[model samples]
Target chain A: MSFKDSYDIIVVGGGPAGCMAAYAAAKENVSVLLLEKDRDIGSPVRCAEAVGKDGLEKILEDNINPRWIAATIKKFQFVAPDGTVIFPQVPMTGYVLHRKLFDFDLGLLAANSGAKIVTKAYVNYLIFENDRISGVHVRINGVQHIIKSNIIIGADGVESRVGRWAGIDTTVHMKDMETCAQMTLANLPLDDDTCVFYFSQKRFPGGYGWVFPKGNKTANVGLGISGDRARSDSASARLESFVHDHFPDASILNKTVGGVPCANRLPKISSEGILLVGDAALQANPISGGGIATGMTAGKIAGNIAASAIKSDNISADFLKRYEKEWDTACGNAQKRYYRLKEGIRKLSDEQLNKTAHVLKDIPQKKQTLVKIFQTALIKQPGLLVDIMKTLNPFS
Target chain B: MILLHDNKCDFCGTCVGVCPENCIDLGEAELNIDHQICTMCYKCVWICPVEALFAEKVK
Candidate 1:
């Protein structure tokens, strides 16, 4: 698509969040432009590609395509440090997605909604007029172009520069970042419906290893360690050791590495005509580091708010503040509760984790649930007990 | 000084995200580190998943 001189809304990044923002804005009959720095919308997938089924269905509704799903997860297996296994029968189903196909479909949806889409377009910086975000200077196909927009949505991932360039404090503390590496292994024996998590401070200090089945005897095996605990070895090295020990005969197909911000959402996600979503806003789940569902939620809200503000001819920060308030009510508040639970869980020792697993193993399988497991594991953390109740409470 | 091994680098931009100085930039297929502002804190070196970045001493 040809670059326009100006657009009503410009979304920087072409991941799920950015595409949803563009799609939402364009559905409102606004001129929108979506820019992706990579050669394609979803090449070099960096995510674990897992999302809760209900969360995804809420956004896609009848539009959910079967081609985008790799595995329909039915259960979770938690392996404690001492090899004690605990089955947490989560009430809802999850899906291990084919992220490339899923993301490409979202981009297509945006295009079908009249949003212009461009790839290999790197946004260098933002343009300011009267100290308000007005446009962006981007390089496409090695050529520079200046494009103006009434509002800019920074859906860029963890390394988001758009937020930084806009003078928002997007800095993440070392401890809050999860350094991650994954390899798609084939010829592996695995259940097509179960996700496995390995918890060991010695093996994956401060984080955990995961084996998410992608169906067809293949799976994405990976591990993430907090940045503070990542000094001794690289994430790939640790993953290699884990893979070697567990899936020695499995052939490696693809290797990817990235960082996930497990911190709470940025204190300020909007300022003066600019809004940030997804990893740029640190919207991932603090405990699991999953952002697909929350990112899309925030993106949809931001896109709608941006379009309405433009219609009213008031794109000031005061008007954009509505985005933050709406996001807090939708997901940000729940995210805060999760962050607190994560803090409490982070302090559990290997022995404590093993003991918790043993305690849960004694319970009848029919009575096992996520809340019951958390209640048993965090019996001493009275403060987090309330946070867990608020976070997991169905009626709340 | 820090050196980047291009062959080993995956251009995943993990280094760019963790850099305290915010001097690294990940372009479409290239990664650049600005030595002028880098304090040699080596956060990127330690955090690189592929060990693409390393610290070097200049004579």
Candidate 2:
């Protein structure tokens, strides 16, 4: 088979969002191509690699193959700056993943569904004809090629040039951006079945640090500092200091540094013949910065819509807004409230975090329900109560 | 032509994508901007997150 000069849809990026978009769009037997800039599907791991099992299962149809799972967590531990630990026994599960393998598997599924997947194809710009997006010019293997497509899906990650080139205003505010550093460490004594989150404005101003165990003696330890606080000291330095102080004897296996956009969903996700999905559209959770499930959810919606529009021969802006409405109803509506709660919680001082833990320690063990715990922790921000409720219990 | 900041360059390669001339090549070892082929689009200067790329004198 030879490379085609044109396709029905072109997806730029090979991460989860891009793969899912290609998989969903190609399900209808339309000619689709997925372009990945990197030679490998997933080499440089970014996120903490921990995701809620229930949310992931709901999106993946409860068929998570064990091959991608690094570890399964049964409980969550919250640590305040004063050494107070609060274990929340919510009936939820967490999964620490081997991201390199998971990303490769997603790409394979996209190829199996009839989407042509290519690596090292770096998209340079969008082609315009009659003031509308026609296709993309990409660089693959030191050669430049202009690949035509009826529609373009910009599933490229944060700091996405696809959306910017299309004039979609994809800029993220510094306050809502998170600069993170993570290291996979070995020989550390950790609870493999627990996800521990540490809060201290002193160490991780405007954000937090986490340790998610991947195996019996190995773990992913990382911290994120809000962009506003990261101006002086890079996130790398902060993580290095935290790791040395907390896990002095731990040996580092791998290290990664990146940023996560923790802002509200873009006011506009679709324009003309282009649709931005996942981090490109700022679909990450505001407080948690978790985006895998959200990216898949949006990718599935955009892909199904794009293919349907191609069938009807109307890939117009008005028709594509159907995806916007559906996604807003599915996840964006809840995320609006999540953004507010994140801002309120991010401003909490280290003194307040310690005080809240002290108060919680004195409370009787029987009264420590998830709802009660959140209620007390957020008592000062009464204005955010209802939104927090919707955030904590999306089902309700 | 595009001048690079050796210290501020994090190898993000935002410039490679934004360059209209496609004169910039980001390899594993170095990010090179071929001055002979560059059209001086200056998009790379505006696109760099760290302000690592700049135009010393408009070509």
Candidate 3:
């Protein structure tokens, strides 16, 4: 009914990463506390709410929730700057999710694993002693509480204060950050199940605009521009103008605007008694800025590692180094490749992007696969071939 | 302390969500920062979409 004197692990932030961390740690019979600043588990969702099917399966395994799926899509369409529409039939398939339900369900799983789930708890400061983080000072329902913990998992997200408080360099450069805006629109004449992505330096600068179908008559329309490349308008303004120009008759149901860090992963993620997971550690895909899958994976690794470290009676970063190694083996290498590819693509001129679209368009549909698409995208950079090989054909 | 450049800000609330001090506040029509509570951490400055917030140097 009340707070405990101490916990084996404390996970700050109850997003997918936090929930997964709590669940994994609790499974090992460790006392884990999951704190969320928001009154509800999930509200005012900031994501565009889509995840690749293969990546999602790897993270969730057999624990897929049918209630959380809004749409399963296969068709892929890319729009270029000069109004060039290219349908590159690739092997990738994905699902647009109902994020609210998904986030709440993940937290429920964590609670079921015996982690103490506390909502409306805003962590104002880390309780540090002798250069080590031991716990946090959280305000729950206007009542301040000091909860002690041996290890802290920082899953707080892109603008995370947890990592910074623990003496990690959590600063993200402007070019590495994506200024994003999204609107859920209903009553639109969206006929296709295909997700459309519009790329134009003139419109979005370093990123692209996307429309993921939620159902027959509705879709989540959004865009993310490189923060440093943005000349004047905010992401929300650009998205509003884009929607007005493109989907004139569509009516908006909800809106959200925020930042998503698509930068390179930090060299160091764990410290004396703290582990930074998800966007806090910059695990989001550099190219797509989609992090749900990666965050979930990182949470599982960090949680399990924290539990093991507690049992070992050594809370040093040296003991938790396995978390970084495991993550690199899982998806870190691929993320690095994506970062390089993003940098390579950023230099491509608008005329060159249009040309690439035209070149891809002329290719036969039957011959167009994700491998070939990457080949086209990386024609200039031959070094990416190995990464593409590993990603497309992991076994070899 | 930190200063909020009103003209550059779009009031996206990204700064509000990340501020550990709860120094930054977003209203329906205005951006407010409580200077008393602000510790000059600069989390908001590094993450602001429009470069709205910045650290005020102490002389």
Candidate 4:
């Protein structure tokens, strides 16, 4: 009813990352409080909704509920600027989630795990005690209240202020930030459960576009462009025009806009009693701007570590650093590599994208894993070939 | 007014490629349609992975 004045762990932001952190921490029987700025559990959906099955399975077990999924992804298609398509063969892929439902469900799971959920509550600052994080200062309905907690987790999204409040340098450079816009349209004919990706400098310079089919002739269509190439153009306006031109007959459904943090993990993510997860930590997939799984994965580790540190009666920076190490080993390293690959690919021209598609199209559909496609792109640029060679080394 | 999130349309032409009336066109970040000739079937909305376009019932 009033502000939660105390808890074992306080997680800021009720997104995927925050939910996971609350769930995991509560699982350890810790008193956890999750604060969300939005009034509803899941409002203002900001995701493109396409996640690979294998990638998700790596983070979650098989028994996940089916209500969270909108559709199961079957095939993956890659397209060039001129529309040269390359069908990549892979095992079972992931799904396109109904984020509103999925996010709400995740919060409920955390609630069931004995975590407190507070909506429309904005965390204004970290409550510091003796130069260490002891709790959070939150504003709810114009009332400022301090919540004392042993640990604080920052999951407040791409341009997160929580990390900054915790004294973490969370600024994302323009080049590493992906500007995204999307819409849900109806009456558009598309293959059920197939996600299509497009690469072109004109449409999405230094990034790509995607169409994740959502059955019944509807889809979540969107594009991601790096901030460096965005200039002064309104990315949302651009997407509207594209839709009017391409699907003149498709009826409009809804629109959403947001930014995706394409940056790699921060140099440091732990400070005294604070831990960062999800987009707040720049844990999004570098190449695709997707973060559901990565955020969830890091959340699990961060929550566990926070509870353990509190139990051990130590909240020093050195003790909290284990959260970063565990998270980095689990998925941070792969994200860093993907970021490098994304940078390399960003340097390519539309013509290069077309040529790469041409070269890769020759590969049999059965052998079109992402690695092979990357290999094909590198073959055209000998210098890039060397970089690819270096990147290919597992140790690197 | 019905709108599209340009940043989200991947331009896979799923909307246009699949539009029976061929309403959707591909160019830059603009997912445009010939509004005068458009039908607003919303087939594109259902097919979009990024939810780039939406059909609004102008009451």
Q: After superposition, how far is residue A238 of candidate 4 from its true place, in Å?
A: 1.8
lDDT of 2 by residue, A3-107 (tens): 799999999888888888999999998999998877888766677887888887887788688988999988777899988987655667789998899989888
Please write out the lDDT profile of model 4 over residues A1-396, one tens digit for every residue: 844578988999898889989999999998899998878887768888767666566666764678778778877888899989998765656788888988898899899999999997877677777877788888787688888987889988764667776777776666777767888889987887788888888988877878887778889988877766665444676687778766778876777766777878889888888899998888887877888888998898899998888788787889989988998887887777677777778878888778888888887888776667777775555555544544442111
Q: Write the per-residue lDDT of candidate 1 for residues A1-396, one digit (tens) a residue.
A: 577899999999999999999999999998999999999997879989999888888887757999999999988899999999898877778899999999999999999999999999999999988887889999999999999997999998888889889988787777889999999999998999999999888888888899999999999999999888888988999999999999999999989999999889999999888999999999999889899989998999999999998899998899999999998988888888888888888888888889999999999876777788889888888777788777763211
How do all the candidates rank in terms of TM-score, highest first?
1, 3, 2, 4
- RMSD (CA, Å), candidate 1 to true, equals 1.7
* Poorest lDDT segment (10 consecutive residues) of candidate 1 chain A: A387-396
Considering DockQ, where higher is better, how would the candidates rank from best to worst?
1, 3, 2, 4
Error of 3 at A219 (Å): 1.0
| Count of backbone collisions within predicted model 3 | 0
User: Which consecutive 10 residues in model 2 chain B have the weakest lDDT in total?
Assistant: B13-22
Stretches of candidate 2 off by over 4 Å are A364-366, A393-396, B1-59
Q: Which residue runs does candidate 4 get wrong by more than 4 Å?
A: A380-396, B1-59
Query: Per-residue error at A376 for model 4, in Å?
Result: 1.7
Kindly indicate the candidate among 1 and 4 with the higher lDDT: 1
Which candidate number has the best TM-score?
Answer: 1
True contacts kept of each: 0.66, 0.01, 0.18, 0.00
Q: What is the interface RMSD of candidate 1, in Å?
A: 1.0
